[model samples]
Target: MEECCRLGLAKSIGVSNYSCAKLSTLLQNATILPAVNRVELNVAWQQQKLIEFCKDKGIHVCAFSPLGAYGFHWGTNAVMDSPILKDIATAKDKTVAQVALRWVREQGAFPIVRSLNKERMRQNLQIFDWELTDEEVRRIRQIPQQRACTWKEVVSPDGQYKSLEELWDGEI
Candidate 1:
C-alpha cells in the first residue's frame, strides 16, 4: 500500500477481494482512503451493505461480471436463472443481459462488463441509453444473496477466515 502511494503510479489504490477487516487495517495504516474497491457484484450477488459501507467511506465500489457469465457452467446458478430478470427483460423488450447491466448502473456503481461478440458488446453499452424504473431496481436488489466466486480452496486452512462470511465480517 505504501509503495502505491510512493510511486504515484495509481492516483488512488484499493483492493479487490479484500475482507472488511483487511480494509479496516489498510485504512488504519494509510493516509488516504481507496478510490475504488472492485468486487464480483451483480443482480443475483448484490453486495448491497458492503457497497453502502464503501460509499460511506468515499470509496467507489466497482462491479465486475455485470452480466452473469453464462460461459462458465460451474459458476452458473439458480439466481442467474431468475425469472424476475427475464420478466424485466421482456417488459423492456431488451435482452436479459441488458437488463442485468442496467440494474448495476442504476445502483450507482461502475459495472465492468465484457463480451467478445459484437452484438453483445453493443447491447451492453446500450444500458446508458436506457434506464430501469426505481421499482425495477428495488426488485432486482431483492434477489437472494449468493456468491458466484469463492476463494475457499485458495485460503490456507490455518487462515483466520474459514469462509467468506468470516472474511466479510459475517455480513454473509
Candidate 2:
C-alpha cells in the first residue's frame, strides 16, 4: 500500500492498531514511510512513547477513540468520567468530551470523534476554539494511566498475540 501510494495509485497509506515495535519494523524496511497511524488513544490510554516515536518519524498519530468509547465492551469512560477532567471542564466551561478532545490536540495528534446527535456533534467541533491551560495539562498528565482498549479476545495463551505484553510489545 505504501508503494501504491508512492506510485500515485492512492493518495496516502497508513496503518491501524500497530504497536511501536510493529511500526519500528515497518519503518526499518519501507521505502515510503507511513503517513498516519490510527490508534485507540485517549487521556487514560495515552500512548506517549508511541506518540513521540511517530512524531519523530513524521507519522501523524490519529486517535480513533479520543472520547474513550465508553459503550464498547473493551472501552471505558475513564477519560470522560475522571474527576480531574470533570474539574477541568467545569473550570473551562467545556464538556468532558471537549476537554478530552482538546487534550489530544494539545498532544499534537488529531482526534476522531463520533456523535449522532446534532448538539453533541457541535460540541465535539467546539474543541478547536479553546486550549487547555498548562496547569490543566499537568493535572491531566498526572491521572493514573491505564490502557482501556486492550484487544483481549486476541490475546490468549493460544491466540496470535499470546499475551497482553506481547500484543503491546510491553508498552502496556
Predicted structure with the largest lDDT when compared to the true one: 2
Candidate 2 TM-score versus the reference:
0.94
lDDT of 1: 0.76
lDDT of 1 at 89: 89
lDDT for each residue of candidate 1 in 55-85, tens digit (9 for 90 to 100) = 7788887887776565575355544477889
TM-score of each: 0.87, 0.94
**Candidate 2 per-residue C-alpha lDDT over 21-79 given as tens digits, one digit per residue, 9 for 90 to 100:** 99999988998888999998899988899999999999999998898897887788788
- Residue 123 of model 1 has an lDDT of 81
